[model samples]
Structures are given as C-alpha cells and as structure tokens.
Target: MSRASPAERDERLDPVRWHRPTRGTTLRLISVAVLLLTAAAVLWFKPATCTPLLTAPGPTASSTGKAAPQSSTQNQARDQTEGKPAARAIPSGSVGVPIRLADPTALSVVRPGNRVDLLRLESDKDRTTPVANAALVLEVTGADDPVLGGLLLALAPEEAKQAIATTGRGFAIVIRPS
Candidate 1:
C-alpha cells in the first residue's frame, strides 16, 4: 500500500465521517426515534384498516326491507314546496322543535329545507303571535350571538305541542315564500 499521497489524502480517518456524537451514539439515536414514533402512533390510532370509499349501508330496519339512498346533495337544497321534495322535510309524524332564533339575522337565510313561520315574540316591544304555522326547517344551529341562530323545527303533532310549549318564551323566524 505505497501509493496514497496528498499528505495521506488530507489526514484521512474517514469511515463516512459523522462521529462526534456518543453517549452510546445518543442512545442509538434515541432508540431509532422512539421506534419511529411508536410505529407512527400505532399506524395513526389503528382500528380503521380500510374499506370505506363511500360506505352507505347501516340502516337495515330489519336487514332487507329496503329504503336507504337519499343523497342528491340532499335534494340540492330543496324548497320546491308544493312540488314536495327536500325529502319531505321531516314529515312522518314530525316533532323536532328546537327554535331559539328571534332573529340572529334570520339564521342567514335559514336552510335545510325551508318553509317557516314561528312568530310569538312580545318580550317588551312589538307584538307578534303565531307560533308555528308552516314550520319545517330541519336544522340551522349556530348561536352564541354572531347575530342569533338556532331552529330545528319539524313540527306537526299539534305543531309539536305549540312549538314545545312556546320554547322558553321567544321565537321569530318567518321565511315562507317558496
């Protein structure tokens, strides 16, 4: 081995260089980075090993009686009213009733299947009193007062018992023109 020279190749001690790190090489690089982060947190919280690219199957009402496939983006924001389509906005002996809106900007054009009336108000101001005439807006919640909002309503059963006995004495949501 007599031909290596440029001053022994720049004072070589190279075994692919990186060496000053020890405490047993930082405990074997922190045990291979905690065993690759506990195997990526057990495959990222296990229990879901596949099979779900559009799973709609759990509503068996008795395994095979049939009836489960309504999703045209929920009838494309329904509201044909007399043409009856937003999946009958809760009409099957209805009784949902949540209502709390007294005007939180009319729950931003209330949706989920329009058709409403609700009124009742009168808490120290302009009188109004109808409490459920049309009612069917099946869900529009979001009210910590970013302009008031909350109205589940599906009524009928004596208008869900007069809108659940006048839901805490306050109401107001008129939208009925469609």
Candidate 2:
C-alpha cells in the first residue's frame, strides 16, 4: 500500500459526535422521574376508602331509669328514722327562770316583761356553753286586795290556768313562783 496523505489521515483519526441521546439512558431517566412522581402523589393525597381507628357508638337509653323508685323509697325511710320532736315554747301563765348558764357558779334571774339574750361561749378545750344575760321588770301582781299585800312579782298566767303561755318576744327563761 502507498503511504496515506495527511488529509486522509486527519479524517480517519477524527472523533464521531452523536446528535441524539442513547435509548437506554433516556429510558432510565424517564423511569426515575415516574418513580419520584408516584412518591409525591402518595405523600400529598390520602385514600378516601381508609377507615378511622375509633368510632363513637350511637345514642342509648339511660342506665339509671330502673333505680329511681328504690332510691325514693330509701329516702323516705331515712326521713322517718331521723325525724326529731318539735320544740315547744314556754307557756304564758308560767314564769321563766334562767337555769344553767356558761358559769354554773353564777346565779342570774330573768323576770317577766324583760328580755334575755343567750350566747354561745367556747372553753379552752373546745367545749361550748350557752350564757344568758337577763333584764328584769318589777310590777305588783294585785293592787286592790287588802289581804294580798302589794308584792313585786314576775308575770305569769293565773294559777287556775292549766297551761302556761309564753310571750315569745324574749329569750326563754322558765321560772316557778317561790
């Protein structure tokens, strides 16, 4: 063979440049894009068919309806057992006397037509006692009868009356005539 010309040698040694991408490379890139798109869709959108973990039950009838009658009966029995006697007021024809005060050693008198005040006083040991403060009124029982001397006495119902009457205005002090 004869020696090749310089131009021919240059043409043979030049590199071949491709204008379009390779089929395998294009397919791989497209597949990667598709995978990324599927992942994004899964993150952004949730399926409506999925059910919640917890659901509330529908309304039901009350459980306590049957016990009402028994509860009322129990309440009535409690009231009957705990009932106390009603306090009675001192009678009018009877005189009121202060019996026991906070201080047992002290003596105090509450005459008729006067007021008495009662207060609760507590001792050092936490025991409480009722103390009475009295006001006295002096009046003669009978003025016309010479046989019956004019005597300073407290007000009370007539001796013949069987029941005593309480005035109810002042503190209760029950006294018997001496």
Candidate 3:
C-alpha cells in the first residue's frame, strides 16, 4: 500500500467505538457511592447515653412520715442485701433570691444546678466583699435582655437575706466548680 499522511493514518487506525464511559466517570461514581455510605453511617450511628453519677436526691418517703413498715426479717434481709446504712433525709426549705449581675454577659457561663459565690461591690470605697458562698443557681431569668440578666439563687433564709441586701450595692457572681 502507498504511505499515507500522518493525519490520514491516525484517522484510519482509530477504532469505531461505542459510547463507553471513561475511567474518570467510573471513579466519580465510586466516589459518590463512598460519600453516600459515609453519610448514611454518620446518620445511623448513635452514641450510648449514661445517667449522671451524682443525681440530686429524690423526695424522701420519711419526710411525709408514711414510710411502709418492714418486718424484722425483711429489714434484716434488706440490710444484708444493701450492705449500707440508710441515708439521712435531705432537709428542704430553700429560699429564692433574685440577684442582678453587674455584667449580664457573666450569666451566660452560669447554669441552673450550678453553685455560685455572690460578691458585693462597693463603688464608693472601690472594694469587693463576699456576700454568700456556694449558693445554688435556681433559675436564670431575663435571658433575652443582655443588660437585665438576673439570677434566682436557692439559698438558706439567712443567705437569701444577705444576697438580696447586696442587690442595692451591685452584685457579682463567681461560678463554682461542680
């Protein structure tokens, strides 16, 4: 046969192929499938939930003076099985005191069930004094108002008086560790 030009030789040598997908297309499909599987795994997986180690004490049956009486045999069985003395009932009567924070942004770090120490700020003397220690945070109010964020603290009657008294002089809260 006569020698053909390079362009003509390339055209004749090229094979007549059907519309087959390229390697890049196959790789793209595999990548999409892997991404979908990863998403499904993320959505389907669930973490185990555990109860708190130190939960607040529940209301005591002894408080109402209506606890069921157990026979001596039953009491002995319970004592042996439990291997511990009965816990004393927790005393209740906590008073709520509404105390304002000097910096409302500080309340963002405080949560209900958290304990705080209250302090009184003396503007005239430029001194800070402790008002109450380890006061329970009962409620956080005025959350919508950045400047009016107030705290409702659960305290003993005397402690409540002390916290409320410091409201006029301006108050600050110190978040305590659990």
Q: All candidates' lDDT scores?
A: 0.67, 0.38, 0.70
- Cα lDDT tens digits, model 1, 1-178, are 6889999877997879654896998999999999999999998996844433222324424337776643334343443444433433355567677777655777767776788888878766678878677777876766345355587788878866776666344777778888
Q: How close to the true structure is residue 36 of candidate 1, measured as C-alpha lDDT? A: 100
Q: Candidate 1: misplaced stretches above 4 Å?
A: 1-10, 13-15, 18-21, 42-95, 98-100, 105-126, 130-141, 151-156, 161-178
Runs in model 3 deviating more than 4 A are: 1-91
The TM-scores, one per candidate, come to: 0.32, 0.21, 0.48
Residues 114-145 of candidate 3 have per-residue lDDT tens digits of 88998888877877888788987766766668
Ordered by TM-score, highest first, the candidates read 3, 1, 2
lDDT, candidate 3, at 12:
78
| Candidate that beats the other on lDDT, 1 or 2, i.e. the better one | 1
Residue-level lDDT tens digits of model 2 in 1-178: 9998988876784587456878998999999999999999999998865322211223334466543211223433443477621112233344433222333222224322344334344434453333333323233222234234222222243321211222222222323343
lDDT of 3: 0.70
Positional deviation of 124 in candidate 1, in angstroms? Answer: 19
- Listed per candidate, the RMSD to the true structure in angstroms reads 13.4, 32.3, 13.8
Candidate 3 TM-score over all chains jointly: 0.48
